[model samples]
Target: MKRLCTATLLLTMLLSSGCENRPKQYERTQELFGTFVSARIFASDEKTAEAALDAAFRRAAELEQTFSPTIADSELNAVNAAAFSQETAVSEEFSELLGLSLRYSQLSGGAFDCSIGQLIDLWDIGTEQATIPTDEELHRTIHPAAHEVISLQDRSVRFTDERVRLHFGAIAKGYIADEMKEVLQAHGIESGTLSLGGNILTLGCKNEDEPWVIGITDPFAPQEITATLEVRDLSVVTSGRYERYFEENGVTYHHILDPWTGLPSDAGLASATIISQSSVQCDALSTAVFVLGAQEGLALIEGLDGAECVLITDDGTLLQSSGMDAYHVKQVEK
Candidate 1:
């Protein structure tokens, strides 16, 4: 399954015009590697904005082609295929992502593992043929390669078991988003926002005046926002069951499988949103907190510096981390 990509638009006026010039930069869905990408970015001017957006989208597609499991030639997929059998030297991007995944896995106590690739493929959460896999099959397929199989040696890599596969679905976009933010800043484009799917990163502000206002879409009602958070120079990433799923035999199964059970995490929470300075951490922690549940997730966020979380439960309970109440969350009656 995948997270939906949407951005809160900026509506600001050039003071002299006395009218709002809130034009969208580039908003469209295109097939990148094997999946569709909903991409958007905001910039001060149209030409440079479009150029930067094109560069970002191209880079992301390049990464996907290199890392996507659907591509046999992908370095990552090949690496996964050879796991436990041979050693593979990966590109800088793969190494960086793997390193980040390892760090987060340790920090989250294995709740966030990139090694859930086998289980993800077994469930096939995004496809039409999604079903509840047999326990025997799950047990056989669900292997936490993060802890056992995958090993990072300097800039090279090796797998202890061929059965272990790695997937970067959870964190790659955020990393890309962060990179694109840097690209935009380097291009001298200040006061803009870029959203690669749901991993959003903003730099400067809208027109150098207003802080970017990002809407936290309700997991239950994505068309409607649950709250609005004012931000600048930050990234917001969310993990939820609503973005992708399928129903079979009256049972609903979404992505976001737990590493421990190889099943969809039924952590009583419907959604978890994370805000941090690094888009990579924001994206990783969104999935981490989803698996950690509400209380423990809050504790984890509290322990981490410069991290904040908002957890919305299945029963309409809103649990905010210590600093998230400043978002002015407006509770709606059911």
Candidate 2:
């Protein structure tokens, strides 16, 4: 439930060890999906690089129109507006993404839910008019029973309850990033980096031998890097309470809400970073782990194959998944 902001650009690229010659790199940044989207591609010529970047941006824009819940005419908005009224026919792409989101919701035991839009609108964390809703208001408005209401049939969806609403804020960027990578590859651009706010998807590598170095943001001080991860052809997504929050009466409220309580999660976690082959999986898992808390989050990651995560607690302790130690470089002490 991260707000579309400049949170992910904190990922600074580090110099690769023993890498003297770098490929011809072309990079560009644009505003999309309510935040900054940047792409770096290494190609044979400038024209080829620019064309690939253009294609990537175009793909991102298209997906934004399809997935953004805030956009009035978006496919997701259409589904929300039609809840309990009729079965809305969606595109194959939309259906697939929705299906994937539901799968994550099931896996996390509802810790991460796409249908928490009602709760999100109640809190309105990123808006200027955001406020803390009363417990009664939350209880009355919160609708996390999406599993009971939503029915997916091929490329169509129906909600049996009018209260059900869909929001892809948790997983859209990762899916778009993965799509952008595919667009880049189709244009003969093999090596590149797609930074969609907080989701980072590396395309191949900087060179044949050098793995891209990604700096993990310190949840307490996002401007500083608490650790670095060296990865290639993988997605590194970090979900943190510090990414979007508002302070009221000397108390802080973040964007990640617990679906069960319809309030900001008090899961004692500052951030959760997930690394996996699929950006969509990593993106959903990061939020899921953050909401699941440290112990349960660690267990979830351990049980999954090809997934690893580093969970930073509010008290500054770092909890790593069983497979995370191999990619964990240096952890900074507070």
lDDT of 2 by residue, 1-334 (tens): 2533434433322334434445588999999978999998898788899899988899899999999877889988887887568888998889998899888888998888888888898889888988999989887877655565688888889887666788889999989988999999999988988899968999997777688899899998999989888888999999999888999999999999998898889899999999999999999999999999999999999999999998899998888888876674577666
Candidate 1: tens digits of C-alpha lDDT, residues 12-110: 233335534764465545666544555455555678777876776777778887767877788887877665676778888889989999889888988
Q: What is the C-alpha RMSD of each candidate to the true structure, in Å?
A: 9.1, 10.3
Best by lDDT: 2
Candidate 2 regions exceeding 4 Å error are 1-22
Q: Return the TM-score for each candidate structure.
A: 0.87, 0.91
Residue 83 in candidate 1, Cα distance off native in Å: 3.2
Report, for every candidate in turn, its global Cα lDDT versus the true structure. Answer: 0.78, 0.87
Candidate 2 local distance difference test against the native: 0.87
